[model samples]
Target: MLSRIGLRSFRAVRNPVRCLTTKTTITDHTTGRVITLTDPNRPEIADYPNPKPELAQNKDPYAKYDDPQNRRNLNDPVNIDDDLYDMWSPDYYQFVSDKTALKHNAIFFSLVFGFGAIIWYFQLNPEKPAMPRSYPFGGLAKELGSGNAEDDEFYRVKPDTTAEQELGFLDGDKDISSAKESYIQQNADFIKA
Candidate 1:
């Protein structure tokens, strides 16, 4: 039965206790209409019609394309020579400013790159010590030496010539030497006399 009558009337019937409410009244400026906001559920519209200005009947149809202030006209005489002396003109000033900006930027980058190169060179190419440095492992070599100056001299020298011939170890027939051969003899019978 409540569903058939609708929910809004059912709500008023169920709640008999009445509560006093307030209404706000405002006037529309453009249309000069009085508006009363009696219910919170209903939306209030503030929009009004904005009509365009009526154009002059006898005026040119292309007059809309003219500058807003109508300062420049098509019939006005222009001098070509006067443009050269127009130093304060926006276009001329912009070109000159752009050229100067480019020059300054180039100078700044060149100085930066030059300073960076100088710093890089000093960092990479460090000054050498007046006296040459001794071998780091020379102490170990000296301690293990058998007191042979010529043998120990190899470790102390800058470029060690520790090849076989330099150490008096010949190329052929290692068995001929008094010392034992370094390599094992795989086929002693196949050895050439």
Candidate 2:
């Protein structure tokens, strides 16, 4: 003997969720009709009329020839006519040649002037005698066996004093005082007395 068993519940399961695979149909805004073709997955296929044979092989007005081998060769020499060269007069060549000669003459004159100026300058002031510059401050001190301060003091001279007084002043001679006193005395009579 076999026993029969019954299901406790018979609830139907919900359909499984699917992603959207088909795009929405596009429509013209003015005409308000579907502008795009219907889905291809449909059982009935729509027939598309073929385009005219003459219009099918129509070329673009802006399209250029597509032959890459017909490109210009840069290595080829330029073509010039002998008649074009003959059009120029002989005087034109002479003018260009004369202009070149003038430029050469100008350059030659400039070089000659520069050399003359250098020679004249050397002749006016020879290299041997450059006024015999006095020794520098401390240099003169070493030469004279004195301090730079003493050498500087010796060189400074008053306009009224004579060269003899200046020499005596530098030598530190006692005669300098007597000489100054006598000179002052000689000039004293001429001074509004």
How far is each candidate from the true structure, as Cα RMSD in Å? 27.1, 26.6
lDDT of 1 by residue, 111-148 (tens): 99999899897896665453343333543456665366
Steric clash count of candidate 1: 0
Kindly provide the TM-score of model 1 when superposed on the true structure, using C-alpha atoms: 0.16
Tens digit per residue, CA lDDT, model 2, 1-193: 3233222111111322222233434443333445333433431222222222221123243444342232223442222232222223132232458789899999999999989898897785555442232233433544455455756556533232333343332433568888977888999977664
Clashes of each: 0, 0
In candidate 2, which residue ranges exceed 4 Å CA deviation? 1-122, 125-136, 139-182, 189-193
Superpose all Cα atoms of candidate 1 onto the true structure and report the RMSD in Å to 1 decimal: 27.1
In Å, residue 9's CA in model 2 sits off its true spot by 99
